[model samples]
Target: MPIDWSPLKEIIDQQNRFVLTSHVRPDADALGSELGMALLLRSLGKTVQIINPGATPAHLQFLDPDGEIKSVHDAPALKQAILECDVHIVLDTSAWGQLGEVGKLMQKSTTQKVVIDHHVSSDDLNAIQFKDTSSPATGCLVYDFTQAIDHTPSARAASCLYAAIATDTGWFRFPSTTSKTMRTIANLIDAGANPAELYTLLYEQAAVPRLHLSGIVLQRVATACHGQLAYTYVTQSDFARSKAHPADTENLVNQCMTIAGIRAAFILVQQPNRKYKVSLRSRVDFDVTPIAEQLGGGGHRQASGAMLPGPKDAALKKLIQLFEEELKKQPPAEKNH
Candidate 1:
């Protein structure tokens, strides 16, 4: 299914100074899409600034060698940019809550904003939104946008697009990955992406904290529904013991699905504010996006999440019950083999 990019292209052509941003706790896709789009816009002689609510994770800093992503400390600078820029290009996510302070600023600013995302939207931004749930990653959309504008991205832009699509599709292993996604990725590689280096930088250069945190989370995994559902959680204590930031725990939840018969996986991490941040994953059967939506979040079928209030054990227990209830409603044909 091809996305009609004319509206987005029209908006981009109309704008000059642009601000690019993404969801908080920026993932590779979020940061990658922003960087990739910024590169494209700059190539067209548009002034672009990539302002994010959080710092780039240590693992993903390789994408920006010059420290291009602006953080909370640069809020003052972003304020000026927001006032002066003609448009805001929100990437990867459409949830205002996920955008943190950047969302608030965009809301208050008079400047026009557009969302270039590939998520189950959390709210109606009432702005020009080019959202396609079927696209594996917003980087894919960004790639399409470059093509629509008749510009070939430089090697730098291609590498950023590669990271964006690669991470969002779980290195092309997730069900969201499609034939078109592969072709788009191939184009990036042809344009000068080094897959081996990207794999090593994105997956291999993990700090000790991530491995330590993974052990703590994995030890707590428990199966339910005849081992069809596997769930585990990380508490504040685990973070303290491991000295791991939330970003370090990326992809840890997917570990649960590695076990045979576990069709759905959940990772509940206790945040500093006493809220439980849940990361949901599905194998070949379940669609956890609706599950996350019911719990005040939205995302793809095989990957989604939400934040839950209450104590860790209590919240986890409630969600597990909900998961079981959801599974019972599904048709038998959807069950994993």
Candidate 2:
């Protein structure tokens, strides 16, 4: 199906002031798309302000060389910018809950709303939403937005977008990586993305405290449904003990799936507000999107996540049961594969 970019293009032409945002606890794709689009907007002489509900993860902060992303608190000026913007662009997420405080503020804003994301839409915000779950990352859609508007990205914009696509698709290892996705990355590299440097910053660089936390996370990995399902968790206490930031746990789910014979993996991370951030990953012949959606989340077939409104222990126990039940529904022949 042809993507309808006219709605977003119209907004770009008609408006000069834009506020860009993403979901809380955003990953590379979210920030990448935000920063890349912000560069495009500024290049066009359109004023841009990036206001995220949460802070950027330290590992990915290099994308913001000038430190443009601001939390609603850190930048008091964001209130006025958001309130008086000609358009508000929400990136990488469509769910109201994922948007956090920004979601609440968006409901009250009468200005034009635009959503650019790559996840399966669970909530319709009645806006001009552009989503293609087929794309590896939201940054791909943002790149397309620029192209549709006839705006060539700057070298910095290309690097930002390349990092976004690279991280979300697991450095092109994930099954979601497409020919178009690779082509986009090639163009980004041609524009200026340094693959070697991005890999070092995104994956190789980690604080000593995070290593301590990883040991704790690995020891706790548990299996269920005859070892077909693997699950792990990181508590707030764990972070406190290791002196690690919450963002340090970002890629722990990938580790949970490294074991042989594992069909799926889930990580329940305890957030500050008593809620748990659930990350799910699928292996061969498995799709965890249903599980994520059941728990009030949505994403791709291979990866998805949700936020639990209960305690971590309770959510962990409950999810164990659900995952076991899901395993029972799978074909016996598929389990050993």
lDDT of all predictions, in order shown?
A: 0.85, 0.85
lDDT measured at residue 313 in model 2 versus the true structure, 0 to 100: 73
- Candidate 2, 162-184: lDDT as tens digits: 98889888789887898988888
Q: Estimate the TM-score of every prediction.
A: 0.82, 0.81
Candidate 1 lDDT over 216-270, as tens digits, reads: 8888889987677898888889999999888777777878889986778898888
Q: Candidate 1, which ten residues in sequence have the lowest lDDT sum?
A: 328-337
Error of 1 at 208 (Å): 3.4
- Clash number for each model: 0, 0
How does residue 66 of candidate 2 score in lDDT?
79
* Regions of model 2 farther than 4 Å from truth: 215-224, 231-250, 266-280, 287-324, 332-337
